[model samples]
Target: MGDGHSQVAQKDKYVAIIDQDKVTDEVRNIALRYDPLNRAGRREGFHVTENGELHIDDEAVIEEHKIVANRIPNDAIKIVRLPAERGELVHQYGENGFRLYELPAPVKGTVGLLGRNGIGKSTALRILGGTLKPNLGAVSDEPDWDTVIREFRGTAVQNYLEKLRDGGVSTAYKPQQVDRIPDRYDGTVRELLIVRDERNLRDKAIERLNLEHIADAFVDDISGGELQRVAIAATLVADVDAYLLDEPSSYLDVGQRLSVARTLEEFVEDKMVLVVDHDLVTLDVVSDDFHAFFGDPAGFGVVSRPLSARRGINQFLEGNLRDENVRIRDTPIDFLRPSARQEMDGIPILEFPALTKKFQSFSLGVESGTIFGKEILGIFGRNGLGKTTFAKLLAGALEPDEGRVDADINISYKPQYLDSSFDGTVVELFAGQVDVYTRAFETEIQQPFDLEPLFDLVVGELSGGELQRVSIALALARDADIYLLDEPSAYLDVEQRMSFAATLRQFVNRNGAPCLIIDHDLLLLDYVSDRAMVFEGESGVSGVGRSPQSVRKGINRFLKIVDVTFRKDPNTGRPRANKPGSQKDREQKASGNYYAV
Candidate 1:
């Protein structure tokens, strides 16, 4: 009873609202069944393939029956769109079958992008920063900015692109992988940062980012944490209209992360900044709003509309977009409450007395502590506060000047720095010591760690995240009495990190082997640890490691040193840092309860 011009959908809701100028042929063709006009005229003898490619059985034969049986019902459009709400199409980019659906261009303040690795977060940032041109989902043809701006007419992003095209805007991008900066630029940190000082704020940048200690050090000789800060400082000194910072807090400890956040808050006085980070607590602190991403990793991504940082983080944790009426995940990711964790049931497996380690300029002293079997003890402090040194001492990789670990224990350690010098493949790397084909390894390490695809890849050819996964899996697979992981979550995506946490919890429960994790990510520590071993003292001068204690007390000890308080999200049980000077922060500090309910 209808013509081929329009189609009405739903019992009460009429959703035939596609504007002609905005729809690309590629996108339109993919959802052609939903278009009444296309549906009526598409009775030709052709078969639409799954990848939307057209194939002819024979050049001379035309069979209308071929099209009859190869049709997708119009209702499947719901599944194609998934969780992305159709509001406005600002930008589209595609490459190698991966598409960045809708991306929002920021004008002012900080906008945080949160999602899994290999999604379109970095691609979106590159496109917005003008480092990469968008193909409008049409990668076969050359990109045309006029067409792009025309298609986005009357939208907020249209004017932004026009400004960019006219050189009315400028951008500075801090890449996600700061470890590669040395390959691109070398020399002293001060020398490199001084040249990037478009605003002549070199010293100011160093002071603000806490790069004063490494200012004169060679870029290639500095630590990962130092490289991260130096990258931020380089961007900070640049005089640009917009700042795109990717993973600014990756290698930083909790104190350094908070300091970096405060620096970012001050730097965004009147400029726009877009940040991509996996640390939820730091992201929450630095961002005023968020653009939550939902998609299959490495396949495609769809970004939601602008949302308040609070609401965005909560909805992402809940795995649903209420406004879009879509489920991004099959189930919500829950953070276990302190009460939900298993009690400390038995005696400590590894015991150590007061120990001291002395370096040329820095020294560390530790009080007596014991790590309980089947319990995860989290080591926390600033970057240079001897967390890694302590782990090395415990693993017997380094000698202590004074006391020692009381009992002999077999230790399997994943160091803070991952070595990519192995000449053989990942399978060959673990060929003899551990079996990678066992059922236990499959469930605990292979599947959760996403290592199946990495079996054939040479160890030296792996990226940071891939190498981290391989290192973590190899360390966990070995037969040892204790597992010590240093910054194991580094370079992992949000989902990967969560999966690793869950796997560790399960591994401990099944094997009864304890893990001592040294990390800077407060959220990860809070999520995975049952006991806390807090390290405190002056950054490079001296460090003191307190005895292992309850998770609440350990968190409180570190939070007090950082001069902040955290409250668990009521819905997800995830810890969220309270804003400094906020009423909640003041209340927690007054009550001496730095880790609030």
Candidate 2:
């Protein structure tokens, strides 16, 4: 008992007892005594060092417990481990020479990065794209491959770097800011795609993405959804060994997103693909595996090792990293039941009578609909389907050619694409509404969306995700009877979208304010809506907005028209897009139960 070897013998005795399946309290206590480090971190296993030092088997936690790698290869490469940092910090603690994050290399199949806004998913993608060579804790200069490779050696990343260093891997990256696509290109969609057609897959990509109709449309004249598809097509048609797509699902409807994902899946068969996405359901379907980016937004990020898509998403939702033994969030996110069980009998808060609007290039017809108090109405359709037009009409931002919206109730509208004309900070945008900075609003909006740290940033300088959150929060802060949010889920990562959806739902229920949410992510709609309004018609030409119906009915009708079906996932109860021509798709279509659960 006096010597280390004697203590090791005592530990061995308990190990023998545990091995024999007699895990009594005394034996467990003995195991913990000799293996305190491992016991503290143990979820289901043990890590014993050569010198009989027992520690957590997790690479990230072990790395944290020890000194940073001094000589690169000689010390272990902290790969496949997630972060243990808290979600928010007043300032970035990693600016002076330390890494805000270290990510594991992507595996062969399609890999994904999942986290909230400002979490450095884009940064990780840039690193993988070879645009930003990692400094690897070197402050003065970007580390050369020799230094990088030596540090990354003994991991899959070492081989990736080797291939990159040798020019064996060619990368084509579709950036996150597709909104800027217009600034660089001044041509029709077809012209752009043709120019990017290095692989001669223009025709095939166009057909797969259903871009034939918009082929002749000008790049600058197109909507966000159109730009998103074109960006994907351009990236896909480029000949490359590695493909990096950031937020491919943004502005895409469920069907278009699935099509894009399917194409990427097919193309990745013999290639390396990395995707960063915010929609959990779409990310689940598109990615074979995922690496979670965890930490403060724009502060620092650490990526986890590759996990099966399902586990990665679930872990993100639970805010727990089993391997790293850390909880990034204070509470776990829970998926609601498949259906809304309670019926609202409250009086109508707002009603817009049948409305018709005519445009130079398009026309819209919106059927009369009523929103009851405490209701969340989801609007689902393809892009440019007049959903936004209808919301504008109701908000008095636009006038209907025919009927009129109720003038009694006040409406707060968050536009689909946020334009920052404001010359002040986010906090200033809410100067008159001081409650937004208060603790009461923090629990509902600021905290969940991680907006406090971003309060001082100029409105125009905010990132896409930050802008989207601020826009939604601003709309919510207004004293109005109803909130009209167009694509509120845009730019949000999986966690942010889930958190925002919960926040919106809570806001509506608690404040007795009805909300009309128009978004392309069917999963978000399903999660948030009490009823849904389906928009149908030709894109960029005309659209017909049907009256709001029960969430299930409206979604079913929309899915049926899109020729895709959704089934509830057994694990999470969230809607999942069935593969085209799969048995579920066929059965659901044949049974006339699209979106049936």
Candidate 3:
């Protein structure tokens, strides 16, 4: 969009551009002649014959681009690129930006935007939703529609933009913060949803999302998960050309996340759909192709060209962008297997008998479990299944109705939701906390979380991810035999979640302190725990936590109940959710093995 005239000169070196409409027959023939299934090394040269036939010596490059192009459905509307400038801030509100990347919108399958937070993903989606007109690098002046149309001429996006500029297209956007919906609306969920039902899809959406019971409930009374479903339902009911959802997986359990993905893939097949999610497994399951965002968060954001889902995600985990010739991270994030459980020769750090906690309409029964000095226990359960209730009982924040935690042992607890009530900077809040300032903690917590730059920021003004990191550090820095962290990975991006998991494992192993972590992220749990506890029962009415078992056993038990299965990715060995009713899912279910091998 910057000055039009094919400003892709900088990226031309690594990228091979071919106009699909203008390509010669010979060029097309050569591309089709190559065996798509061949696995041979490709050469590296670009050549053009005198007859205007284009050729690339590198078969791998041709194959890669071919796969991407092939994946784009024949009915794709347009390819969009949002570029960012680096080296200096564009204005008082902008930072150095990343380079140009492309987002192709297919009329059918979803195209995911994956990256760390604050990488202009939301901005791009806003442009697509028509909520924000892209300045297209001309922030100082008004957007020029004529130049923008000319730049993307001969593509589906050009015609789309022309219609958009002329007020012909409509879009429905589900924003990232579903938790904030209550603040903007005051009505029953049904009322809020039905009012937006231009397409008469309210009933269908509600049934698909399992929101029948809460249809008449006030928006203010619903939980975060409920709010998310309601928000998605509203988006679905609206008649729009594009359906954009930002972080639909947040506040949802693994099962619910899958449900949402299925609903979108089923009902929104004919329309353009775009989604942004940090849960790697969810993103992989929901998207056909992905556009990866890379660059310094809050500094500069760059979008990568589209690639097949598996390849793009693998590249992201590898921290390398081969086509862009950039390494976004210092090192690749590995999904390494957890170490074997340590033989606990020492005495148990804490042991609790069967515990019961009852609230107004909810009750939790925790089966007896023991934690050794060298063990970290992971808690897996759906929302309202009393995982947090068990954690609170362990931390003495709540007294169990009928059982007791060891009164003599010390425990530190980080709650599920964070509170930013501190009236000073982050450093000031931890001024006398010696461990936080020590070299060991700095290396383990500060460096990995990138907290050094956030130390001077006001505690009340910190972002969700920042506050989570601070809360984790505070809990770890305290002198305690056991730690209880509830939803510590909430709001953290994939990179931060991976880093935090590593840090937590190191702290638990190094200090020989036991930890009980309750979270919904399966990947983080797999990476950090030696054993897991599965909670089962009615979500709100009653929940029963089973005794701690091996990680695989617990995961298998839980996933079996939820009717889902995981398979290991051949490239990264990461856990990936199998499509429901797929061959792998059927095979695993038949064999009574839900966890990946």
Highest lDDT model number: 1
For model 3, how does the per-residue alpha-carbon lDDT over 162-278 read when each residue is reduced to its tens digit?
877898878889977676677789999999987989988898999999898789989988877788889999998888888989888877889989999989987787788888888
Best by TM-score: 1
Whole-model lDDT values for every prediction: 0.75, 0.72, 0.74
Which stretches of candidate 1 lie above 4 Å from their native place?
1-96, 406-408, 423-425, 458-463, 569-573
Poorest lDDT segment (10 consecutive residues) of candidate 1: 10-19
Worst 10 residues of 2 by lDDT: 9-18
Model 1: per-residue Cα lDDT over 407-497, one tens digit each: 4799999998887778899888877668877887788777777776678778888877789899999999999899999989888877778
Residue 568's C-alpha lDDT in candidate 1? 76
Report residue 479 deviation for candidate 2 (angstroms).
Answer: 2.7
Candidate 3 global CA lDDT score: 0.74
Question: lDDT score of model 1?
Answer: 0.75
Where does candidate 2 clash, by residue pair? 101-301, 118-297, 118-298
